[model samples]
Target: MYVTTPDEMRRIDNRAIEEFGIPGAVLMENAAIRTVNVIEEKYPALFDGGRVIILAGCGNNGGDGLAIGRHLMLKGAKVQAFLFFAEEKFTGNARLNLDIYKRLGGHIELVTHEEDIKTLKGSIYQADLIVDSIFGTGITRDIDSLIYKAVDMVNKSPVPVVAVDIPSGINGKDGRIMGIAIKAQHTVSFGYPKRGHILYPGREYTGRLHVVPISLPQDSSQAVGVKTFTLDDKEMAQNLMERPRQGHKGTFGKVGVIAGSLGMAGAACLTSMAALKGGSGLVTLGCPASLVPIFQSKMTEVMCYPLEDGQKGYLTLDAITGIRDFLKDKDVLAIGPGLGSKCDGLEIIRYILREFDISIIMDADALNHISRDKRLLSDYKGSIVITPHPGEMARLTGKSIQEIVASPIETATEFARDMGIIVLLKGAVSIVAHPEGNIYLNSSGNAGMGTGGSGDVLTGLIASMVAQGYSPYDAAVYGCYIHGRAGDYAREKWGETGMIAGNLLDELPLVFKDLFSLKG
Candidate 1:
């Protein structure tokens, strides 16, 4: 699903009004009508002799609230509107709606003073539902004025609140709460879901999201630079093709996973198992010689190769030639899960960066070693994917963890664009930034996925897809979605507290089966 910024949404709204010859008043009316429809359909008994209070501002959002009040009144419900601004302050479509509501003999009260706030509070205390249209996506600053007080009042009230466009005081572009934001039960977004609705903090405030189409042309949104998108199950299915009946093991592709040391053998096992479960036909785990025995005993289906190791049992630079020979027929190489942070291991990573020609997906220790010299990414020749959590990303980019977390999309996008590679910033909203400048935010996964070995599983999944002939970008997108979906399934079965990285592997078959069945 395409996500729009406030500015981009405005451009699309404008194009619909100016270029498409649709009137702004009509769009406002449609938005209000759809919002009311949602309330009625979702809660049929809400308007059965129940009083509703509409808290409106002087902007278009307020105009939508006024229209909703009028429609509710027409449906034999008691509706009262509290305009935060002076009655005369409303203009355009908003003013027209207010006039229409007044002409219908609807009750409208102007709230401008402290006494008015008290009366508004009394009215809200008696109302069954509240419609919050105080602020929309155009909100740019923190709410410190009277509106802040009103939002606090609404949040404190027990009545269910339905927000118009976006919850009041949320920065729609980035999902940050502007000092204070309304805790809304439902948000009626016009045309498409805003970035705030899917992003954190703002998502927490928005209880349930309902996107109501106000007739904005999709092509207009695309034309106006709406590049960010969230994936759904259907699109994910379309991205993956059905398996061929005549396909052999080599037809799927061979994955060379260089991971694990002496004590971190579990990391190697998880990654190799994840690759197999991720639909790779052949998986070869190249680990230190001492660790090979453990992997051989633990993993039944995964093939193994013993590479040269240092005294500490970590893969050394000498292992690079052996790994290169091992990867001769491999379609993709997944490096760096549990590969210790030793200098020799770093040397092996550097060797792969300089000489490896196959597509590479680096995670964990590989990312740690590369962060020591990020210049390798800028000069690398082959397709590369780097999956880094916040701390690792900070080290790689030489930025503070605070800076990267504050603006993850910008950080990932800029890195991907400049480095000409794919950067997967893994966290709450896993962001995949492509070299071509398109950004995708993953919509699946839950807090349960924060367990150890999750990143290894993700790296294996993404690398498996790449080996199966997917572009680095598509592989990252699909792999992230499936990995998250598997996590979701695991969470559903075992709850968040019991979910582990291995649980993701257990659910992979069910996820792939359900998704691949869509091809029929």
Candidate 2:
């Protein structure tokens, strides 16, 4: 599904009214009806003569609340509409709805001053549910302090709140909260989900989301280009990498992973084990010669290579020659998981970027090395995937961590577009951006996946997908989805607090099993 910005949504709405001939009043009525349906379907108990207080503004969102009040009244419920603006300020579809609601004997109250907030506290306390229509997606500034008092009162109330379009005080273009936003139990959006509905902080406030088709023609949305989308479990399950019944070990593809130094040996072990568990036919863990015995003792399934090292346990400049020889039969190379930065290691990364063939998943210390000279990525020819968390992304983009975290989707998209590479900005909501300008927000994973070596598991999984013939872009998308899903599985088995990176690796097979079963 498309996730549109507020401006894009406005353009689409205008196209619906002017070009498609869907009247604005008709759209408003439809939006209100859908919100009513959500309340009926999800909170049927609200219809048992419970008091519903509609906190309405003076705009179309308020119109939606007024229309909903009329519908709730028809359902034999005690509905009260509280208009925040003066009665004369109502105009457009909002005015039409308010007039109809009043003509239908719907009780409307005014909350025009600071004193009105104190008077409304009794109504708020007595209500079973509140409809938050104070602001809509077009709101771009902080709300006034007077409105803040009312919002805070509603939040403090134990009543369930349902929001229309989006929660008030949320930036529609971005998910940032404007002063304060309504904490809604559910949000019924018209036509499609807005960026705020899916983006952070906003998503947190938008309890549950239901996008209703409010008479807007689907083609109108296509008229305005939509390149941003999110991946769901069903789609990912169906599009997962294929598995042939007659497939042999070699049919799955081989992955070459150069990771781990001395103290960070766990990074290498986790990456190699995850690659094998992620369905790679073979996984070779190439580490410093000193770390080989450690890995050999740790995982019997993964093949091990001890390359010549300049340092005691890190892959040095000399190791690149051996890695080149090792890549002869490998389908994908996954570099940089705990491979600490040293002078020789940086030189090896530079060599790999310029000289490596086949797809490469550059992550961890490798990304740190490239961040020093981003120009190394300027002329790279092969398929490339960069997995960087916010801190790593900050280093790569030369931006502050706060800047990257505030707008992960934009940061990932811009970097991918400029570098001509796939960039997966790992976060609570992982964003996968293709060089072609398409961006995907992953819908899987949980906070428990933040454990150490978790990124290494993602690196291995992505490389495994690439080895299995997925394009670098698809690999990143599917890799993030699967990695997150596995983390969720691990969390389910062992609570989120106890789950570790190895648990995520252990659950990869279960995640793939479900995906493959979906294909059948």
Candidate 3:
């Protein structure tokens, strides 16, 4: 399923109308009907005959509320439509909905001034439920002081509030609160979920999410492209169930990971160990010749390839050509985390992405190098995946980490689709965006994963998944899920504070069992 922003949603709507011949009004009506189901199920008693107040703005979101108001009133509920923007503020289908609603004898009220707000206070408090449709996704800038005060009143009010689409006052693109936001007990979302519904702060504000399909054609959203996606265990089971049996080591695939340097050899060790644990049939850890012995001493399972070493046991471009042999018959490749890109790491990475045909996972310094020159994206010849935490993604996209954090879902999705690569933007509710505009949101992992080397493990795990049979999207999604689950399991034994990336390597078998054990 795709998680999209307000603007991107509009594009989808436009494509539906222009290309698929689905009219705008038809979509709005469908949205209202679909949302009605959630409303009915959650508050059956309230919708029967109790007083209901809908605080609606002058947009499609408000239109959805107004349409619902008509339905509830016809069903014999005492419904009051609080039109926040008055008559002149109405536009498009919104205006049409209000006109029809009023004509149908649906109760309507205006909230124009502070006095009007005070006048409605008693009704607001007495109402069983208030539908917050005011200032939906269209609200990108800071709201007026009046609306801010209203937000306080709504949150403070004893009446439970339900939000339409995204929570009112949320910047859907970045999940930032626009001045203030509605505190919803439930948010009825049309089509799939949105970034604000999944990303933090805004996610908390969204409350319980109720997703409804609003009669858009099958895959109709594909026209304008969707950049956000979410993954659950159902996804893992689906991917796992699809894997063929009787697959030999060659059929499963191999991954060559070029990692580890002076002090970061632990990164290589953990990543190599994790690659094998993550289902890679075979893994070769290509490190500076000096590190090979250290890696070998640590693990007999992984093959350690020694590259030409230089001063103080580091890798240079001189040693990059040697990586070619390891590439033979390799299914996927991962670079960075511990690879000393200081000498020729960036150049080596550039050469490999430009020259190698295998699927790739770029992380840590590799991401940093690409941040310096995004031109590397256009020059690449094969399927690609980049796992960048907020900071790294910010560096790669020239956005501040603060900005990205506010809307990791949107920024990551846009960047991935725009650059034509699969992007795993790591953080809470990690987002996976593919070049085709499909996106996946991960639902696993815990706070225990907030440690070093977790990312390196993820890089290796994703590369392993890609090598084994997963698409770039599937690889990133499953890799993050398993990585998080490993952390979760580790947390159970070691507690969040004691859990570390190395702990995940030993717990990988447990994670695999949990995944494969799930019944259809």
How does each model score on TM-score? Answer: 0.97, 0.96, 0.81
User: Per-residue alpha-carbon lDDT of model 1 for 432-496, expressed as tens digits?
Assistant: 99978798888889999999999999999998898788898889989999999999999889999
Candidate 2 lDDT at 58 equals 95
TM-score of 1: 0.97
Candidate 2 lDDT score relative to the true structure: 0.87
Candidate 2, which ten residues in sequence have the lowest lDDT sum?
341-350
Better candidate number, 1 or 2, judged by lDDT: 1
Across residues 146-205, which tens digit of lDDT does each residue of candidate 2 receive? Answer: 788888888888999999999998888777899989999999888888888877888899
RMSD per prediction, one decimal? 1.5, 1.7, 4.2
lDDT of 3 by residue, 1-520 (tens): 6777778777777777888888788888888887777878888997568999988889888888999888888877799988778788899999899898999998887888888788678788889988888877767688776667777888899898889998888888767788889989999888777777877768889989888887776675566666556666656766673456877777767989888888889888777778888887899988888777788998899998888777556787778778878787788889887875564777787878767778889888888877777878756878889999998898898999988876675787788778888889999878887776566777678888899999999998898888888888788888888888888889899999878888988788887877777735
lDDT (C-alpha, whole model) for all candidates: 0.89, 0.87, 0.82
In candidate 1 the C-alpha lDDT for residue 82 amounts to: 93
Q: Best-fitting candidate, measured by lDDT?
A: 1
Q: Rank the candidates by lDDT, best first.
A: 1, 2, 3
Better candidate number, 2 or 3, judged by TM-score: 2
Of 2 and 3, the candidate ranking higher by lDDT: 2
> Which parts of model 2 have CA positions greater than 4 angstroms off?
518-520
